[model samples]
Target: MGLNANDRAIASFTMAGHALVHWFETSIPIFLVVWLAEFDVGVALFGIVVALGYAPFGIGALPGGILADRYGTKRLIVLCLGGMSAAFLVLSLATSIYAIAIGLVLWGAAASVYHPAGLALISTGVEERGTVFAWHGIAGNAGIALGPFVAATLLIFLEWSLVAAVLAVPGVIAVLYGLSAEFNPTAAVEEDVDAGPDEALSLSEFVSNSRALFASAFAVIFLIVAVEGLYYRGMLTYLPEILHGLAAIEGLVVPAGLEGIEPADYIYVGLLVVGMGGQYVGGKLTDRIAPARGLLAIFAVLAVLALAFVPVTGMGLAAIAVLCGVFGFFLFAIQPFYQNAVAVYTPADTRGLSYGYTYLGEFGLGSASIAIGGFVLGEWSLTAFFGMIAAVAITGALISVALLAGLDRFIDTDRSVNANADD
Candidate 1:
């Protein structure tokens, strides 16, 4: 079915918001290479410093969710966009590593709100959530693809600071657009909309609700998210550097005018471009099939790809590119499935908090990759790094298998309880 005017507008704005927020988040890795040269720091130090930014991105999700639940999703989203724009402007003006670190922290704090707020909006606001989420994931991948591409391309011709400032322009536009857009923020329960913050769950009630969620199969879902986070952050955080090292082994070079650009940059961007399609397919599959079954298939693929990436790098550029496409496809494809999974597993009234915790695992625990990447690259072999990533993926896949088995039982149990309560 075609989207009506409201669906189109909400999806477009929300997706645009998703793209711009991610654009800033993903572009930082590209800048890390530049920072290493400018700051003359080791990989470990850079990783730790950058991880500071990443940690806040994760840590802030709880508060961001609470705020979203209290105030409204749209307000926090606008705050996110406006705050990120200012943070980038600060990043542009940085004169030292300290300043850069501060900017990154600010960016992290600002960026933190987006996932909870934006996803909450989509979950509550849109009727055809699967399709909208697919499109949203596609938009996010577009940013993921282009952020590095744009940053890499600009670094060749412009200063890094200037490029950051230039990138900030889009966020400004997004904020303006968000302010003017008339979109609905639907609550999971209609009465919840009229209820004030006072009516939100009390501390003990919140704890009880969380316990109920965790006691069921949703606990397995959270574990899967955590494992996926480790792999996701670890692999992507240092991907360009890893690829660059591989290129150096083969003595690869780019053409003139693309000087200073590494083969990894192109490959990384291309891989993410392929992820756009993955997002669409994953979204479609989650809607059309069972999410757990689909998740199992994708996580299996991710495990294989993580292990294969290093081995494939030795085979030459063509093989590496193909591996990247496959890797990127499965990596991103799993997202919408798991996101939809969260919505299904939890009660709707607490979805913002659920996503808050979901991302807390995905981003909070996921932030470990920064330190993991730093230490692995600084002290260990590339084999060890990929090995750890492979292990993480396999572990996640195992948990997902458990989730698949138990999903129906837990969901049915919850429904029966709710039905009995109604009667």
Candidate 2:
């Protein structure tokens, strides 16, 4: 079905918000290379510094959700956009590693709110949830791919500080667009029930709501999100560096005048570009199949990919590129599955809170992979780093199996109980 005016507006705004969030997020890894050289820090220590920003980006989602629930998504999203832009501006001015960490912390705190607020808006406002999600994921992956492309491209011409400043401009523009866009945040929910204006919850009420959410199948979904985060953060944080070390990658020819650009950077961006297709395919599958089943297969594929990545590097460049593309596809394909699972398992009233916890597991707990990946890469071999990644994906696959078997039964029983109570 075609989207009406409301759905279009929400999709547009949320798409912009989604893209901007990842634009800032994925760009940081590109910056990580520069930081290591400029600051003269070890990989392990620098990984921890990077984690400071990303942890808050994930950790702040809980409170960001509460704020989205209470104050409304539009306001929180605007704040998120504004905060991210300001943080990058701070990064542009930083003169030391300490200053860079502070800027990242600021950026993380600001960017953390976008997923909860934007996803909740889509969950509660948009009429066609699955389609919008596909587009949403596509936009996010666009930013994911483009952030590094843009950052790397600009770094060749401009200084890192100027590139950081230039990157901040889009967020500011998105903030302006957000302020002017208007749509009913709970239009979808209002059709089924009277989802009135959200009210602030007291501390006790907040605790009760959170407990109830955790008591449901959402708890398992949270575990899946955490492991997914670990694999994602751990793998992507140093992938460019890893690729740079590959003989096949470094041996590739670059077009003239762009010698400043790394071939591995292009490979990294191409992988993310392929992920856009994965996001769309995964989002559409949610409308047709059980998201849990899709996740089961996707996670298993991710595990296989993780285990095979190191081995693939020894192959020719074409082989490496193809494997990376496939890996990128499955890596992002799991997002919409878990995202849809959150909406399906939880109540409409607490959509923001549910997504908040969803991302908390994703970004918050997942941030640890940065440090872990860095340590493994510095002290051990690429084989060791990927083994850990494979382990995380295996964990996700197992959890998906458990979720399908257990949560399905629990949901049925819970629904029957609710029906009896209503009767």
Candidate 3:
């Protein structure tokens, strides 16, 4: 019932690492508002600059995973933390928009190493997979919530560059902590630890495994993750702006204590804060139910809620709060399910690569949301923007249905092979 010492250690370090990764990733959006003012660029140009950083974060994942599988997960993680710390320090010295863009590209590449390394470490290393994934998702959402909250609070007094430097502190500390820590990844499930000659695949062998993974249920899972990434990146990139527009139209009152900060930002942060709970509940559900069933239910609700978000923003604060809370809940709640789905559907030997590809879709292709959001914002209305996101979510729901329908095939294939091997 209780996590052993090793479990606690692994969870603490991995969770801390995840939180810092998110802190760096999400903090950029908070600063983007300031960048626009300082640089005198419109949202479209700003989005391009932001995407420059984001695209590599996605692109680096594939290699990050390959390196993790070869060099060891701990090594890649330390590299990621140290690299991110240095990148943020680079960002703090920016004198021009081009300088800032280059720094973001550095940050993005460094940041890309995290998801594959961290998620792969946990998937293969931990036993209570769902709970660990849930806590991991919570840590991520905490970064999402706090990154902006901290940036906003500091911006009230400090300059943006100084704020960027201060944010680097956690990454530095995490790197130091990682250096002195030890791990026992050998204590994982029997199959993972004993994955035979294919445990560490050669490049050609890895290519073969990757192909097989895609040909099976994992490909459907990848598509679902891609859709989720698009929706997530597209909407969250400009949620504060979207909410600001709605609040202005509906005439919502700002609290006296928070009057100095934008009301929409507070609402944006509040929604993410609420999503922390969603991560917990979603993690729990993964342990109790089939992950596909959970994915189906979550995607379906997300489709409805995504469509409803713009309309609800005009209804009043109560309606906005309720819908946003539900929306935030489901948004994060799906993480563990899909993460769990990856492990269930892939081989023990290639788990690291599996997560690498998973996040490749989740963050890599997901990075396009910045440009997509900008284009829609520049050319279309918020209603149209959210409509497109809703369509993607609905598409993910259909994919989930396919995953569920094919579940038996996935299970039977595994059982049949194992039975033959035993015979």
Per-model RMSD to reference: 3.4, 3.3, 3.9
Q: What residue pairs clash in candidate 1, if any at all?
A: none
lDDT of all predictions, in order shown? Answer: 0.80, 0.85, 0.78
lDDT of 1 by residue, 319-360 (tens): 888998988888888987777676666653444577788888
Clashing pairs in 2: none
Choose the strongest candidate by lDDT. 2
Clash count, predicted structure 2: 0
lDDT of 3 at 85: 89
Q: How many residue pairs clash in each candidate?
A: 0, 0, 0
**Preferred candidate (lDDT higher): 2 or 3:** 2
Best model per TM-score: 2
Per-residue C-alpha lDDT of model 2 across residues 114-196, encoded as one tens digit per residue: 88888878878888876787678778888898999999889889899999999999999999999999898888878664544
Sorted on lDDT, best first, the list reads 2, 1, 3
Ranking by TM-score: 2, 1, 3
Model 3: residue 304 alpha-carbon error in angstroms? 2.0
For model 1, the superposed segments whose C-alpha errors exceed 4 Å read: 1-5, 127-131, 187-192, 196-200, 248-250, 287-289, 405-423
In terms of TM-score, how similar is model 2 to the real structure?
0.91
Q: Which 10 consecutive positions of candidate 1 have the poorest summed lDDT?
A: 414-423
